[model samples]
Target chain A: MNIIVCVKRIPKTAEADIFIEKDNKDIKKDNLVFALNDWDGYAVREAVLLKEKFEGEVIVLTVGPDESKEVLTRCLAMGADRAIRIEEPIPNDGRLIAETLAKVIQTGPFDLILTGVQAEDDGWGQVGVALAQILGIPHASIVTHIHIEGGKAKVRRELEGGLEELLEIKLPAVLTIQTGINEPKYVSLAAILEAEDKETKEMTLEEIGFSPREPLDATIDQVSFPPTGKRAEILKGTPDEVVGQLTEIIKRKKGS
Target chain B: MSDIFILVEHRQGKIRDITYEIFGLAESLANQQGTSFTAVLLGHDVKSFADDLSRRAPKVLVIEDENLEHFNSVLYQKTLSSLISKYQPSLLLMGHSAFGMDLAPSLSVEKDFPLVTDCIGLTFEEGKLKATRSIYGGKVNASVSLRESKGYIATLRPGIFPPKMHGEIKGRIVMEASPLEGGVDVKKFIEYIEAPITGEDITQAEILVSIGQGIGGPEHIPMFEELAIRLGGTISCSRPVVDRNWLPKERQVGISGKTVKPKIYLAIGISGAFQHVTAMQGSDTIIAINKDPRAPIFSVADYGIVDDFQNVIPILKEKISDMK
Candidate 1:
């Protein structure tokens, strides 16, 4: 049961100070830090666990320019048998990326494909499902647990209101894994050094027969800070006095 | 023929609230384009839900299939693609819920339609549709537009649109049958296991007093629980509390947890992350108490107190008791 996992490189959102560019069409990348997206870490771990248990190969793929190779190498250190990086300077468009991924994936007879439910940067959560559709296979999103038996993939999908749905799809399906499905393992410096000798492959858009004659299906027009919807009325006083004022407001509101 | 098609989403024979929210956007867009809108329901034996939905729109398109009694995206995509090819509505809408998130992206790709997900607002300026979506963990908003296409598909964030009632619009219902042969068999549904309601369902609560990692330790939970009870509310916490085994999974509030809309919410000690804020920001009133003045929670809060919740909770409880 060979598996292919898709990964992406994103800015370290929590540590970075994000600001919209003067053109309002992009973000300021001067001091921002980049790493493998947090959610994709879980995806890579899940794939490695499956390969370790089932005795099959795991291949990881990513789409970006030169810098994305860092994440691909990290996946190899973590236990993916091989890594593939599509060398292309693409916009942050989910559909366009999914198309390129589908073309590259056509080269393999993978039994399963996994991806983070959403990227931390754009948070589109669309690429995995769109790839499944382009390849004409079944897919599920927000999957928290997965078990394979007899060429079938049984998954637990997380739904709103604390509900879980148990589903089974045939082999060769796509699953967009949710966060916290498992605690991703930590990689040590020793493992990173060992990974330097592993196999890493690179492909171009033209190599994959992906030629775009038209514009992206959807693109960001402008970016800006979210409006401070309602400025909070800051209650400034000693704790006791402020408590008194809050109590009065609550009493009046409850009465009305 | 500019028409909007809102896919009616339901589970276990009960309609989801997002189905109504979609009507709000569809109505506004339809009015702007001088066209009609249809509420499309696809399930087994959905007559009652279709009837209830007819009062809200100009038309309801009902499609029934035994395979659709439960949601399998393969079946939904196949059925919806056929419907779109036959009708060719200018716009299609759905809720950005678990089901919608699973279905819309694949459908858009299969049909070569432009799609956008997790939208908060939509506008038509100069005859082009622009959608506003959140980025940078809800700290920024990006306006996006679709390239030239025949139609567009969008999934709206729940609780963002204001649902309106149209008592006078008695809509007509058009019925149809499944178009596929034996429903595509890419996947099969097994069962739905609802996480047991260990305590109150936080999503149903009117008032909620929620805590976060800053609650310091497990021993401090009882103090906040008492305050919540006194204030006629229930206690809830962020995902970390549940991960720490300090609280039950039922009490967690966030994207992976539960999306709740309460009348009054008090966020105590929670550093406002987008995952946490998107779940509770729909509350009618929000009050945040955190020692750090720069906590993101204060930005969306209606009232803020930059003080230790430990000192503030006790005094606020005493004051409420005295008022009673």
Candidate 2:
């Protein structure tokens, strides 16, 4: 019952203002704190819970530059048995990341794979599903509850419009966890100190037997704020006056 | 010939609304490329579904199988990939809903196609497909262009484009079988469980009095609840309120939560992050009140007040009570 969880290092969006860099290609990284993606925290916690129950290992993996080790280390501190960071300044392409993960994961004896439903940066919910396809295994996304029995795992997937679907997938399957799946435990300072002794492995793209695929053909042409149309009429004056005006407008619309 | 293919999505014996929205986008895209609007329907007992879709597209391709009765990405990828290779459509569109997110990623990888998910807009300029996607939630829009790829795939955000009937005439429906040796065998279907709708279901509310981080703390929630009750609407909140446990999960609106299309949306103290904006962008009338004049919610709001909601809610409540 070995579990593998994929994590990503992302800038804390809730903290500072997001500034698009001068290159317009990526964000300004200076003065920002990087941490495990919010959803991935749940994946790491879930994997650790499964490992604790089944008495197996929980391995955390990531594909990024050297700084990504912080995320893997955080996962280790949260009870993952081992941490592996693929030392590459990977592109934003989900396919490339999926390819790298698939190559590295196939070498391990893993019965399950877990990842965040989507990354906070690119917001592309592709890597987990694509990785499962590359590994030729069944996968489910937005999974809320997972129950493992004999060689199969029964999980519940959150669908649109407040509905949930249940599926029974065999072992060696991929599951992308959604938020609120569980309240991730807070990693104490002592746990971080203890994780310093645990193993943290590093791998390169070539070491994973990865031949570089053709660069992804998609490129961001331009990034800009959504245009503000001649729509919202800003009300001026004190709170009382503004509230009166708004109430009048709503009344007129309601009557119409 | 290069065609625009729309993968029709359905649940509980009814075609989802996003399928028609895809048709709306596909029809315009096909007209631009001088190709027919082609819809690919895969489901069980899809004869009536195909018939309904005939009014939307000139060609509806149907694939019916009990295995596909419920969506399995494995089965859909196997079925759609064969169809894609056979048709070689230049463009493909699907909803960014649960099913499309599950299917498109794997299918794109298997087919080696350039893929973009959760697109709000699409256009073709100089033979390149530029897809408008939201990054960092809905705060910014990035125009992504496919670089000379043979085919393109985009999963469009639902409710952004309204579906329209093309004409009075019904188009042709062509039935096809899945090419898989046997139906999806890797995963077994267990059961479909409806996520318990906690507290109240506010998704279908006509008037939504929504609050956000501006509410300060749990003690301030009753004011908004009373305001909503007075207005004969329901009380909702952004994710932060749910995170604080001020409201239940069912009352939250955002990408990870539920999408709501209300008639009159009163946003109080919400900073209007993209995650929150994407869920309620389809509302007919949006009114935002925040202390910060720079809140992004104002840009999309139909009416905005730059002031403290605490100062304004009492006045608003009084005015409404007087009018009633």
Candidate 3:
């Protein structure tokens, strides 16, 4: 069995310096530090689990500028057998990324494909479904658990009302993993050294045999930090008094 | 004449709530632009759904195929991208649901258009599309506008816009043959495993009693559960609670988890972060109980208590238990 995991490089929120570009109002990404998106980490971890259980090869793929290799390297260090970098500096939009991935996956012979439900930065949560569409395969999003046997896969999807729907799909399907699926393992020092020596296959847009059909017209016009909220007023009083005051405040606010 | 396009999302042959919400939003934008709203539907046996959508009064384009009976991004994007190019709508609106998330970016990339995902608010001015989204998780609201004008794409955050009933406005539904040839042939469906049953999902709870890092650990959850039982609500937690494995993933609420709109939300020992706030900001009433008065959760809170949750939670549970 072969499983492919789609990974994305996103700006780490802790180190991200979000500011409006002088000429554009959109959030600027000039100095933001990048890392693998949180959900994608879950996808990679799930693939590793499947690899362990099924004794299969796990391949990690990412589409971004040349710098995206950093994330692919990290995936390899985490135990993926190999990595593929779809080399392009195109905007990290989900659609473009999915399209590039679809083209790449079309050439590979994998039984199952995995991706995170959504990336932390864009939170589009559509890539897996889109890739499913592009590949013309049965796909499920927000999947919490998956079981595969004899070319049939059983998937449980998280739905509203604490309700989960069971879906039965055939082999060679795509599944977008939600967070909490599994804890991602930290890359061991030995694995990191091995990853450094592993070669990555790089593909370009032309190599994928597709071009942007039409130019997307949307752009971030401006970006700014949200205003600081009013500070909470601390009332020093007895517990009874505090409870009374809190109740009064709640009543008043509800009335308003 | 450029028009606005809205994708209608449906599952199990029924339109989702966010579909109407996006329509309501698109209607407003179309009205502001003095342009007509066009809706696109892709699925198997979508004629009935299209008929229902016509009551909303937007021009409808229905693309039906057995392959599309289930949601697939490849076929939807290929079909919708062709329609978008042919119709050339000035703006496209879709719900920020999983379906929209998958289709919008692929459409944007296919057309090489920039896209803004998960927008909470949208407006138009001087022939430009303006959208506002929560940033830094949900701490700050940032407004953005599209630079180019051939078309713009946006996915609206669910629950932000209320669905409106526009009465029956007769519209046309044009069924187009699937433009996708040989249809996606690479993958196949296998099976679905159901998630392990936890308690009720907290996002759907009308009233939620949430615990945070301050609640200590999993051992302390039962005390909050008592409060939840008294209040006729569900017990929920912030991400840290789930991170510590004190609660199941179903009970976690935040940006990465489920977005919730509860009526009465009690925050016990939760320091408000943008990620967590974005999920429950739609609550009718918010009450925060934290030892630190400086916790950000108090900013949007309707009621606040700057006290140790350990002391407050047990007392509140007792009071509610007595009231019952």
Candidate 4:
């Protein structure tokens, strides 16, 4: 069963100070470190594991600028057979990304397409399903477990509140893999260097037959810090001083 | 033809909270825009659901079929596609839950409607749809404008909108059998597996020492457990800790986990993803101790300490002991 895994490059914003650029169109990139999207780690790993078991080719695809090649390389180090980076900046709209990827993916024949449940950046959670719709295939999102047998698959999709629904779908489907689906293997720098056998292919929008059937429907007008209506009072001091204040607050508040 | 429609979501014979929450927005928007607002209820043996929804909208279109008994997005797309074409509602709303995430994008593509998912803020200015979406792991909000079109679609994050119901006469209820003629040849629904809830109920605890991925590894959980005991609290954790099997599902706090509102919620080493924050923000007091000063948790916390958990834990224990 051949597979296509969609990986994304994202800013490490969970622990960083996100600064909206002055233009208000995107986040400031200068102060942030970027890595493969955390959820996409499981996506690439799941693809590689499936390839190992089924003895087929695994392709890691991403839609971003040249900087995204690094994530593709990392996916290759994680044992993906090849990488495809469509040379375009990441778009704010999920539908456009899906369009770009679908056009490229239609060029190949594959039994399955996988993507992270959502991007850590926008958390739109739309690209995979949109891509599936564009390709006219069945799709399931937030998939926690997958078992492929014959030409069909039995998959468990994670619903809210500790519930999972088991569903069976035919092959040539799209699944947005949820986290904890598997333990993503660590990509070693040595493996990154030794990924000589695997290759990263770059493509332009023109090459991918990029033509908007309809104009993009949504545009991110501006970006800003999340409203700080209930912002916390930061304890200013050494660890001892901060701990003194925290414990004091806890002492008064605990069991209140 | 240009109106508003909200997909009424239900599970296990009860209307989900998000459906109500979205009603708060859908009804008001429809009133302001002067377009008819209808609620679309799709399910089998769910007439009561429609009856309940009738009060929320001017009209409730309940499309029932055996295949709709369970939410097969495949069947839903086919059914909703025909309904959308027939009604030609200008705006459609769905909850950004497991259901919407699975359905909205595909509908947008198939319908050629402008799509926005997981919007926390949605409004129409002069009949143009705009939305506020959280980006960068919920650290930033991106304001978006949907292109002009006859049809527009948006998904509201479940917890963002509160449900509104005006006191008035019930609206009309229209019943329609599912239009799709054939069965779902692909994507068959099996059984729903509910993880057995076991262990301590952290939701009841007055103080919760919630650990996140920042705690490093499972080997360190005992240390946090000890800290929890010292603070007279129970040790709960974020989704990642549970994902790593460091803690049981019973101890997880997030959208997919338990919604916790302890007297004093102590979030340790948690960056405060919107999922975790949404659950615990109702706590009487939220104190976040994360080394990352910009962790989103700090924004919701009553007090915050930008320091290493390891260093803060010992001193916190000592200070609490002295105060006691």
lDDT of 3 at A167: 63
Candidate 2 docking class: medium
lDDT of 3 by residue, A1-256 (tens): 8999999888755323356667654556777778888888888888988899998899999887888898888888888889998876354445556777888899879999999887776455657766776676767677778888888788777554344556667778888887777766778888888898887888888888868544434444456655655544564577767765655554454355
Best by DockQ: 4
| CA RMSD of all predictions | 3.7, 3.2, 5.8, 1.8
Pick out the ten consecutive residues of candidate 2 chain A with the lowest summed lDDT.
A12-21
C-alpha lDDT values of all predictions? 0.84, 0.83, 0.74, 0.86
Q: What DockQ, between 0 and 1, does each candidate earn?
A: 0.55, 0.56, 0.24, 0.79
Chain A TM-scores, all candidates? 0.89, 0.89, 0.84, 0.93
Which number leads on lDDT?
4
TM-score head-to-head 1 vs 2, winner: 2
Model 2 lDDT, residue B163, Cα: 80
True contacts kept of 4: 0.91
The superposed Cα distance between candidate 2 and the true structure at residue B191, in angstroms, equals 2.7
**Which whole-number lDDT from 0 to 100 does residue A32 have in model 2?**
79
Cα-based lDDT at residue A201, candidate 1? 88
Q: Which tens-of-lDDT digit does each residue in B1-324 have in candidate 4?
A: 377999988877888888888888987788788777888998889877877787777789988788888888999889999999899998889988889999999999999999988999988886789999988877788999988888899999877787775547488998876788867878889899988867788878988999999988888788778778877889999999877778887888988888999998899889888788888889999989888988888889999888888888877777766765
lDDT of 3 by residue, B7-81 (tens): 888766678877888888788788788888888888887778888888885588888778777665666777888
Model 2 has a DockQ score of 0.56
Q: Model 1, residue B88: displacement in angstroms?
A: 0.6
For candidate 2, what is the TM-score? 0.89
